[model samples]
Target: MFLPDAAATALLADALATTQPDLAVVHLHGDLGAGKSTLARAWLRALGVSGPVRSPTYTLVERYPLASGGEALHLDLYRIGDAGELEFLGLDDADARLWLVEWPERGLGALPVPDLEVHLGVEGDGRSCRLAFRGVAGESWLAALDERRRLRMLPEPSP
Candidate 1:
């Protein structure tokens, strides 16, 4: 979908926040200024996160406690030199229900296969996003999102 501005990105994030299941892994793909963190922050905010949502660029991963009693892990693997580095991050120990990963390519073998992938790219002054589903969970979430959009009378993006 073509996200014409930050508001558009926030709208997409809101859709994702509402449509997602109890458990999900979402991979955010794009270059440095492609708005991956923006979407993540917006989604977290939409999910009732009231505190600061800092980017995990340095810490590698940041965890948030959700109002629904679940946890969300936002990971940025751009600084990792190897996927094996993930072992030290204690990913296996976390009981997070949602995972939002940036630069997932850097931790391919260490990370879980994403239920959904959001690919973002710069287009003029705005951004473009493409959603790809991996399994049944992802498909269901997309269907829910579509239904929500339809109910809101939002137009579908052109191919």
Candidate 2:
């Protein structure tokens, strides 16, 4: 999909709201200014987050309770120089209902394996996105997304 700017990215994020499974790990990949955080913020908002949704770049982790009654942990691993740093985030806990990770490569084996991966790249004045699924849950999410597209709940990505 080609997202022509932050707004288009938000549109994709909003579409993602319908496909939120009970628990899943999502790895968002992209370069700086590629709209990873924008999509994350939009997704959180779509989940009914009424408060601020700030990037976890400096803070490392941010927590949000979904309106549907679950907790989401948003993590930015950009500052993580080593996997050992991830231990401080208490990732071992199973309480997180959803995990949204940025720079998952930095955490590598230390982080939960992603159920879904959203890869974004700069394309012209916009971003190109590809969604990859790793497990049954991820596959289900993609299927749900496809259904949304078929039902016209999601706008087709620009060619």
Best candidate according to TM-score: 1
* Candidate 2 lDDT tens digits, 73-138: 899999989989999887686478788899899999888789989998988888888878888888
Full-model lDDT for every candidate: 0.89, 0.82
* Error at 134, model 2, angstroms: 1.6
Model 1, TM vs. native? 0.93
Kindly give the stretch of ten consecutive residues in candidate 2 with the minimal lDDT sum: 150-159
Off by over 4 Å in 1: 150-159
Residue-level lDDT of model 1, residues 1-159, one tens digit each, is 688788888888888888898999999999999999999999999899988999999999999999998799999999999999999999898988899999999998889999999999998878988889889998888788777772243234455
User: Which residue pairs does candidate 1 place in steric collision?
Assistant: none
> Candidate 2: lDDT of 146?
83
Q: Candidate 2 — which pairs collide?
A: none
- Per-model TM-score, in order, reads 0.93, 0.90
